[model samples]
Every structure is written in C-alpha cells, then in structure tokens.
Target: MTKQSRLIFRNKIFFRLWMAQSGSSLGDWFNHVALAATTLSLTQSPTAMGLVLLCRDLPQVTLSFLAGPLLDRFSKRLMMYISDLVRALVAIVFIWAALEQQMWAFYTGSVLMGIASSVFGPARNATIPGVVAEKDITEANSWTVATSGVLSVVGAAFGGLVSTVVQPAIAFAVNAFSYIWSAAWILITKWKEVTREQDKEESSSYFAELREGFTLLKENRIIMALICTSVAFAIMSGPYFVMIPVLGDLIYNLGGIGIGLLYVADGLAFILSASLVGRVVGNNVTSAHRWYGWGFVIQAAFFVAFAFSTNVWAGMIFIFLSQLGAGILLTLGMTILQMTVSPEVRGRIFAIDHTVDTGVKQLSLLISGPAISLLGSPIVGMIVGVIGGFAGISWWYVSNRERKNVSQTSEPYQI
Candidate 1:
C-alpha cells in the first residue's frame, strides 16, 4: 500500500479502534438477522418485526440529543466500553429468550440493546478524529465506511445461515460474544482520559449544552443542509430493509437465504464504491461535496430501475448498484463532519445527525406496512424514487450556488 493508505493502519490506536468497530459492526448485523428471524418465527406478524425495529429506534429519537451532552462531558472510551458491555448482556438476553421461548423477553432485550446502541453510535463517531492525524481524517472515515460494508457482507450472509440452520439463539450467542470481544478491544486502547475542566468552563448546565448544539446547527448553513440531505437519504432508502424480505420470499421465492444475498450484494457494492470515492475525493472538500450531491442522483436512478425490474435477479443487481451511491454519500458526509466540526461539540453534532438519520429510517419502517398495504411495494418504491430525485436536485442547486459564491469572491474586481 502507498504511504497515504498505510497511515491509518500504522497508527496503532486508530487501527485497534477500527478493528474493534469492525467486530462490533459484524455482530450488529448478526443480531439484526437473528432478531428479525426470531421475532417473525414467534409472532408471525410483520407488525411485530416493525415494532422490534421501532423499539430499537425510539430511544435514538428520544435520547439522541441527551446522549450528546453526556458523550461530550464523559470519556468516549469509557462510554464505548459501557455501551458494548450493556449490548453484550442484551444479546445474551435474546439468546436466553430464544432458548426459553419467551417472546416478551426477546422484545425487552431488543429494546435494551437499542438504548445501548444509541449511546455507542455517537460516542464511537465522536472519538474517530481524536484517534487519527488531522490530515488522515477523510482516509480514516473511508476505511471505516468500507470496513462496515465489507463486514456487513459477512455478518448478514452468514448470520442468516446460522440463524436458519443452527438456530437464531446460536446467532445471538455469537453476537453477544462479538460485543464482549469488542469491549475487550476497547479496553486496550490508550485513550487519554478527558477531564471535565474544559466542559466546566464552556458550559454550565446540561440544557445549555444541548441548546448550544442546536445553535451550531442553525448557524452553520452547510452542515444544516447536509443534515437535511441525510434525512432525505434515510427516508428514501429506509423502506428497502422492510421490502427485502418481501422481495426474497413473496416475490422471488428464495426465502431467508435470498434476503441474505441481497444484503451481501449491497454491501459488496458499497465497499467497492467507498474505496473509489476515497481515492478520488481524498481531502478535497469541494470534490467531496460535488460527489456527495451527485450520489443522491445516482441513488434515485437505481431506485427507479429497481422499482421497474420484474426479475428478482435484476432487482438484486439494482439494489447492489444503488448502494454505490449510498457508499459515496455516507463516506463523504461523515468525513466532512469529522473534518469541520469542533471536537468539543462533535459528539453532540454526531448525536443529532444519528438521531435524525436513524429516527427517520425507523419511522419509515414503522409506517412501511401501512404504506405498502395502501400503495403496494412497487408504488412505494416509486415514491421513494421521487423523493430521492428531489433531494438530489436540491442538493445540486445548493452546492452549485455555494461554488458560485466562492468563485465570485475569488474573481478580480470589475471596472
């Protein structure tokens, strides 16, 4: 590898954190399949599956902002360790619930897992910039995005098989073990403990800290716009998760294993696209913005194609291709946030971002059953495609206007 590529791996702290993140993400997907399969097997209701996702998401919507202040005030490493430990325990709960045939226990475990993840997600994101060199911020994010996608391929595909043949409880047990392993990895990281002196001087109350995060979003037009873009992306892409099983089982007649392949295909595409995006747009803020905006347009195109496809294989191909756009948008958005935001309030900003992004996606999932019932899956895809198209257009307009303003500022004075 080139020196630039080697920089992130060479940094021992970032490398360990990256590996830990990979393991944790792999476990997350594993739990994702296990929980969904187990829930459906027990309740025989899609609504139950929706509720499962909602339980995980509700905490993010409600506590996402609150978690921000705590993340900023506390040590990120400590928060991560605690979060992983809690999630690991929750995973074990799922295993026990599955083995015991207690549906309520499974639901309770899922909710607890969600609550822990709400804290973990923001804390983990907030820690990245501090762990790597300033110049390597974009590269680090690229690697992270790619790592997630690659591991997702492994987690989703194999996790499905394990859940199907061996038993979902076994998959949940594996997931629990993965989180414990992640916590151990975090324990070894040499993060300097964050003292509260800085926070004490900066803010007086928890509410004040929360309000400060809101003000920052209001004051920064670019960041605010990006957040809006993420919301649009979330809404557009969110229903796919709900639809994938329907496509695999009802439409394609391939069942659980087919749904797994669909997820794997998406991940593989994302990994390839993220790598290319990292190489092309590395450290180029302007280029990153341009690519980020264009990515939405690409996503829209693929969504439309996917909606139109009658063949299951064709739909899978489209889903895979669409994630290329997703990969670019996600990688650039994260890199921009890490590079631009002040480290002090970075946790809150990430919290806000995650809250909006995830909350909307979960909300989409919750409403999807009704939406699909009313409009049918094909029409729902079209709706998402239209929304994605509008998002892309607006993003392009905003980004181009910013470019014009910058150009005008740099131009020589007229007579």
Candidate 2:
C-alpha cells in the first residue's frame, strides 16, 4: 500500500478508538494486580481471589442482554464514555477503601468495575465498524488485537514494578487516571454514530428488541456453532488463567513478580502473532480459517507443554506460544462474526458472546482452586490441555468440511 493508503488505513477515527481501548486495557492490568494483591494481602486465600474474580464476571452473565439494549438505544461513543467514567469512579472508591482498610469496599468496587465492563463490552465491539472502511476492517481488528496484546504486557509489567516500589492503592489510582484520560480523548473524537435503523424501528419495546438478537442467533446455525465453539474454548482455557497465580505461588514460588512476568510473556506472544496474522490474513476468510485451525493445534500443544515445564523459562516460552495461538483464533473469530452478522443484531450477539465467554471463565475460576487442591496442578493442567487439544482437532475437521461444502456449492452458482 502507498503511504496515503496506509495513512487512510490508520485513519483518525481508528486511532482514536485504538487509543481509547489501549488506555482501558492498560488500566485493566493495573486494576487486576491491585485487586489480586489487595485480596491476597487482606484475606490470604486463593479461594478468596477466585471469589473476587467470580464477582467480576457475575454481572456479565446477568446483565449482558440489558447491555445490548442499552448499546442499541444509545450512541456507542457516549456509552463508552459513560463506561469509562463509571470505572474511574469505581477505582476512586477502591483507592479510598484501600486507604480505610475496608475489605467489603474493595469487593464492592470490583463488582462495580465489572458492571462497567459489562456495559462497555458490547458498545466497544459495535463501534469498531463505524471507525474504519469496510476493506480495512480486518486490519483494523488486527491492530486493535495487537495493541491490546502489547498493552497487556506493558501494563502488567509496569503494574508489578509500580506495586512493588510503591503501593497497590497508588497503582489503582494511576489506573483511574488512565480511564479519565481515555474518556477525554473519546470526547474529542467526531466519528458519526452509525445507528441500526432496524433497532430504531423497534424502539417501542426493549424486550422485543433484545429477543430479536437471540432469535437471530437461534436461527443461524453458523453463528450458533461459533458461539458454542467459543464457549468450549473458554471452559477449557479459562481455569488455567485463574490458576496462574496459584501456579506462581505453589509451583513456581515466584509471587507477584512471577505472576506479572507470566502475563507479560503471554502478552508479548499475542502481540507478535497478531501483528503477523493481520498482515498475512488481511481480509481473506479462507486464510483466516486455515490459520485459525493451525493456531489452535499449536495452542493446545503449547498448553500441554506449559503444564509439564519445570522451569520458569520453559513455562514462559510455552505460555507465550499458547497466547499467540489464542490471539490469532480470537481475531479470526471476531472478524468472522462482525462480517457475517447484521448490524441490527450485532450488539446483542456480541453481548451474549462476551457474557457466555466470561461466564464460563468465572465458573472455571470458581472450581479451579478446589480441583487443583484435589487433583494436583500437573494432573489438572494435563486434563485441561487434553480437552483443548481434542476440541481443536474437532474444530479443524468441521471447519475444513464446511469450507469444502461452501466451495462446492459456490462453483455451480458462480457468475
């Protein structure tokens, strides 16, 4: 692409959206470290940490549909701004609670942040298509994914360093500031709202509008398959993430620094994979599907390797590849959904997608600790890895068959 073409691809609207998401992601890492540290410091229990995570995801499960209607009813930019503002206030409350030594306040703040996230999730996904040209959508999504990956590494590493040098409360306060900064940047952007007229026509009944999204999902076999695949992926992969800290404490003996390093490793891998895949796949569905299948195979293998590694370096290397695979798969999934779904129902579909995915992760977090306690980390890890591997193989086989069927059907009907 020429310089001008490249510049158009990196349009102002795209940059603004990227900035907002990057800021939020940066703050998210800080929030995670602060929350985990606070709970561990105060309660000194792995189960408590898991419970806190559960609280964070419970709202997604309960309020996801509500979020969809709200996103449909309001301007996405406005909703995003509000979400950031709410999270900022939640962070402030957390800072105060930490200062006051109030445990409940911390939990309350965490739940409130979760609510903000629940609201933000659909709005953010819905807003992406508005900011970039149709031809650039895949690249745009890839950049978004890549930016998030880089931020995750930077944020986690920075959070750990800052938390170690100063205090968790201060780290959280910095996170709050990031939200404020993001909101301000969002306010300066002038992207026109792309409202779904289908949604506007049904404004008379919110529940009816919400039901339409679910109805669409119910009727679409491909979408249903995608959602189910995502759910399975979540269930198989989720507990391992929740178990990272526990792994750090029990298996690695690395503490907060160790946890942060593992996260950084994963994030770095994701960034590299996202960047490469974005260029390679571009807007080609066939290429995306092929890479996604291969990525899953690699991801599952890496997870098994990660489970067996005795050294931090070996574990980090495997975890990095696992995340790389995940990043590619996720980018492909999101792009496919966005391209295939109607704008009218996209918000709700994404909301349900996020809700189910997060719900499975939360449920996994709830059981992971006990499972590890009983089965041992290595055994539990092996089980999860095996399941993921089987699922990946199934996904590849099914997708390949579908691709062949589509090609065969299209041949006779070609123009």
Candidate 3:
C-alpha cells in the first residue's frame, strides 16, 4: 500500500475520531497507574489494590449487557461525546480530591470513570464501520490499535516519571486536561449520527434487544466459539496484571517504575504487532481463524515463559511477546466481526462480546489475589500459563476441525 493509503487519518472523520481516542487512551493509562499508586500509598495492601481495580471493572461486569442495547437505540457519536464529557468531569473531581488528600474522592472518580468506559466501549466499536471503508477495516483497526498502544506506553512511563518528580495530584490535573482536550476534538469532528434501519419486526424494548443479541451469538457458532476462547484467554491472562505490582515489589524490588516499565513493554510489543496486521490478515474467515489460533498459541507460550522468569529483563521480554500475540488475535477477531456481522446488529453483538470478556477478567481478578496469596506469585503464574496453553491448543484443534467440516459440506455444491 502507498503511504497515503496507509494513513488512516486522511479521512476527515477518522482523523478526528482517532485523535480523540488517542488522547483519551493516553489519559486513561495515566489515570490507571495513578489510581494504583494512590491506593498503594494510602492502604499499602495488595488486597486494597485489587479492590480498587475491582471497582473500575465492576461496571463492565454489571452493565455491559445494557451497553449493547443502549448503543443500538441511541446515536453512537452522541453517546461517545457524552461519555467523554462524563469522564472529563470525573477526572476533575479526582484531581480535586487528590490535591485535598481525600481517598474517597479518588475512589468515587474511578467508579464514575469506569461507568463512562462501560458506555463508551460498545459505541466506539460500532462507530468504526461508519468511519472507514469495509475493505480497509483491518488496516484501520491496526492503525488505531497501534497508535493507542504507543500512547499507552508513553502515558504509563510519563505517569511513573511524573509521580517520582511531581505530586500525584498534579499528575491527575494533567490527566483531567487530556480528557478535556479529547472531548473538544470529538466535538470538532461533528461525526454524523448513525441511524438504525427501520425494522418493524424488531422490538424496541431493551430486554428484547439484549435477547436478540444473545440469540445472534447463539446462532453463529463461529462467533460463539471465538467469544468462549476469549473468555478462556482472559481468565488465563487477567492474574498477571493484578499481580504485577506485587511481583515488582517482592521479586524485582523496582517499585512504581517497575510497574510502569512492565506496562510500557507490553504496549510497545502490542503496537509492533498491530502495525503488521494489515499485511498478515487476508480477505477470508478461514485466514482470520488461522491467525487467531496461532496468536493464541504464541500468547500462551509467552505467558509460560513469563512465569518462569526471575530477572526484570527476562520478564519484560516474555511479556512483550505475550502482548504481540494478543494484538494479533484482537486485530483478526475484530476484523472478522466487522466484516461478517450486519451493521444493525453490530453494536449489540460487540457489546455482548466485550461484556463476556470483561466479566471473565473481573472474575479472574477477584480470584487471582487470593490465588497468588496462597500459591505465591510465581506458582500462580505458572499454573495460569499452563492452563492457558492447554486452552489455546485445544481451541486451535477444535476450530480447525470445525472449519474443515464446514468446507467439506459446502464442497458438494461447488460447480
């Protein structure tokens, strides 16, 4: 592809949307690191750190179902703009509370920000089809994901650096400004509202719409399998994030900077993987499935390697590999969904997928803390990696068999 063709932001709407998302994602990383640090500073308990994370993910667990139907019913652009505004307000509150040394304010702000993310998740996915050409979907996703990953790495490193030099409250204020800037970009974009096609047969009730989304997933075996695999992967991967700080503190003795470095390593790897996806992913469902399977296997093996590492450099290397695998899987999965699913149902389906994925992560996070406490971080990590590897291999075998069966059945009708 030519350089001009590769430029995702050349399209006016996409440029604006990407800018907004990039800025917001950068601020989110800062907010995430700051929250973890603040909790550690105040309570100095791993359990407390886990609880703070739980608070952030709790909305996804509880309200993800609602996100789909709401995205379907409302204008996605409007929803995203409103979510940004809400997050901006919450960030301001966080800044104020952090400055005042009030822990409750930070906690409350985190919860609100979580709610905002819960709403924005489905809307953001659903808006992509509206912004880019169908053929360029994979490339568009890759560019967006790659940019976000780089920004996340930068933001995490910056947060850590800022925390060491400046106060946490000041870091929070900078985060608040980032949110406002992102919101302003979205407002400037003037993205057109996506109107749902008129369908007299479909019900307007939220429960009915949610049921429809679930039914669609049930009917599409491939999509169902993909989602199940995603849940399994989340369960296997979630503990690493929850336990990373503990590993840093107890094992590496690197403190906040170590945590930040871990995030940066993963993000950098993710960006590198995403940047290559367009050339790798082809125009067929089978190709998508193949990429997804390989990605999972690579991720599982990396996780296993990561669990066995003692040195910080070794840890970073393995973590980077794992993130590269994850980026590939995400790119292919999203592209397949966007290409195969009807736009009308895309919002709800994407939301359901995200909800299931996040719910699994939440469950994993809840269990991980205790599991680590009981087994120690290294052993717990090893167990998760082993399980994840088995799951990936099993998924690959079953999915390949299913694909062959599908192809064989269709072969009889070929001219």
Candidate 4:
C-alpha cells in the first residue's frame, strides 16, 4: 500500500478495530483444532465430526438473513461490541466442555459463536467505509487480511502445539480470553456511520427494508456474479471442517497435532499469499473477480495435490500452496464488496454474501463427511477438487471475457 493509503487507513478508529479483530482471529484456528480433535477423540466417528460442523455453520446460515437488516439500521460498532462480549461469555462453555468431554456443550458453544459471527461479519465489513476513505478502502481491507494472515500463522502453530502438548482446554481458555481482548479494543474504537434519510426516519417496516436489500441484490447483476464467485471458495474451504478429524483418524495419525501441522502450513501460506495479492490487486475493484477466479484455480490445483500426497509432511507443502490461493481469492472477493457496493446496503449484501459462502460450505461438509466414511479423505478431497476446479475455470473464463461478452456487461442495479 502507498504511504498515504496506509496513513489514512491506520487512523485510530481502524487501528483499534484491527487490534480487536486480531485478538479474536488469534483463537480461530485454535478453536477449529480443539473442537475437531476433541470430537474425533470422543466419538471416533466421521458422522459426529459432521455434526460439529453443522452446529458451527447452521446459525450463521439461518441468522444472517436477520442480521443484514439489523446491521443496516443499527450501530455496527455497538453490535460488534455486544457480539464480542457475548462470544467471550459463551466461550467459557468450551473450557467446561473440553474438561468434561461433552460434545453437546461443545456444539452449543459453536451455535452461540456462529450467531455472534453472523452479526460480526456484515457489521464489520459495513463499518469499514465509515472508518476510511473510499479510495483507501481496498488498502484498509488489504491491511486487515495481511494482519489476519500473520496472526493466523502464529495462531495456527501456537494453537496446534498447545492443543497437542498442553491440552485442548488451554486452547479453549485462550479463545475465551481473545474475545475479551477483542471486546476491549472494539469498546474504544470510534465509528461514524452514514445512513440514508429514509433509514433514519424509519419510514418502512422491517419487511419492506428487507425487501429493499433483496431487490437490490436480485437486480444487481454484478453483485450476484460476485456472490456466485464465493461458491468455489465455499467448496474449497469446506474441506477445513472435515479434514481435521480425517487427518487425525485416517491420514498421518498424529491426531490433533497433525491437523495443526496442516494448518500451520496453511497459515504460513496465508501470510505471504494474502499480503502479496492485496498489494497486486490493490484498488483494482473491477478486476477483483478475475483474480478471485484465478486464485481458486490455484487453490484447487494444489488441493488436488494435497489429496494425493504420500504423507502428512509432504502434504503440508501442498496445504500451504492451496491456502495461498485461498488467501488471494477471499481477499479479492471481500475487497470488491467493500469498495464497490453502496453503503446503505453493504451490510445486507455482506450478510447475503456470507450466507451463501457458509451455506455452500456446509452443504459440502454434509457431502464430505458421509463420503469420507464411505470412501476416505483422499477420494473425497479429489472429488471436491474436481468440482472446485471446474467452477473456478468457468468463473475465470466468464470474468476474463467480460468486455467481449454481452451478458457480462449488464449494468448493476442502481440504488
């Protein structure tokens, strides 16, 4: 990023927000490993692992519809604050569950966290334009991705080692503490939300306002295309939900530690790939889809390689490369929405986008867990790779030919 963009974006408001987000994200991978490893140890069944993911995703998918309207009409920062605190309080359940080896409590905590995350995502994205200039939005988002990537690397390694050496309960406690840390930072961050006069007046009922967001999304060809792009990413990422247990029970057999090693590679790749892609794709909102498609292609290619790996350590390199591509695709997709969408509906749009992302991922997990039990992780991974590869290729083709293709030129719905 340019010095000017950096200076503008790193103002006190966003800096605090970033610090808060980083604190929470630090626990993300740890939570993933802790939950998955414990599930595997407790049940030794892929079916049970699938249930864990279902619990984690169902709330986000179901509640994001409601969260969209709330984000648009309410204070995004305040919503985030409450969400952090709620997550912190509820995360205590994870510690107790880990200590007691209770899957029901573990799933319950996942449900609560998912609800918080559903609100947090759109609220955070919608808050960005308020915190930074339009021109600097991409830079700001890039910085966000870069910082998260860096933290993910350490978080994955530290989380994995701790879960292996110390205990899953310790990781669970860190997750709870991270939420408190996030709540503290967000509590003090300054935010100035810009709203439409109609919104301020509350002229419309809840359903009407929701209809407005839906209509905008339906009429906007560009937005739908961008949203469709997330499908491939969803498929690419779905593996994360199931692979931990698979790696533990079937692959390297190192259990939680093996899964951690996999993510360490993924997290390391996330740092470099996301940072580099952010710089390369900076401010090029129009071309975001092209890079997103290409990133998926790269991700799919290596994911296939990862599926065929002879051992865990060799597979780690492929895992690194696969997530490198993931980092690029997800960063581009998110930056595009932040920079191009209207502020009034950005929250709703983000909600819909996230819903689609998570919904598709959950579907894949539904398929993956059953199939893995039937066929094994390698075969299931190959099948997903094929699906993602085809989807990524088609998306790239359409995006690359935008200027020449008549359908690609269709104007987006005007607000």
**Count of backbone clashes for each model?**
0, 0, 0, 0
Clashing pairs in 4: none
Locate the minimum summed-lDDT window of 10 residues in model 2. 406-415
Q: Return the TM-score for candidate 1, rounded to 2 decimals.
A: 0.90
What shift in Å separates residue 124 of candidate 2 from its native position after superposition?
Answer: 0.8
lDDT, candidate 2, 16-129, per-residue tens: 777777887898889888888888888999778878877776887888767886676668888889989999999888888777878888777778888888978778887777
Model 3: how far is 21 from its true place, Å?
0.7
TM-score of each: 0.90, 0.88, 0.88, 0.83
Q: Quick one: best lDDT, which candidate?
A: 1
Indicate whether candidate 2 or candidate 4 has the larger TM-score: 2
Error of 2 at 218 (Å): 2.0
Model 1 pairs in collision: none
Off by over 4 Å in 2: 1-9, 42-50, 198-204, 242-249, 252-261, 397-415
lDDT of 4 by residue, 289-369 (tens): 677777777887888788777678878888888888888876777776676588887878888888888898888766776
lDDT digits (tens) for residues 1-415 of candidate 1: 8544696668988888887888888888889999899989999997898688778768888887788988888888998999999999989888889988798987777778888888988888888888787667777877887888888877877898899989999999889988998999899987764433454555568888888899999976667878899999889866777777777777778886677778877888888887788689877767877888778888778877776666678878998888888888888888777776777888889999999998888777668767877877789888888887788788778767766665779653110
Candidate lDDT values, in order: 0.81, 0.76, 0.76, 0.76
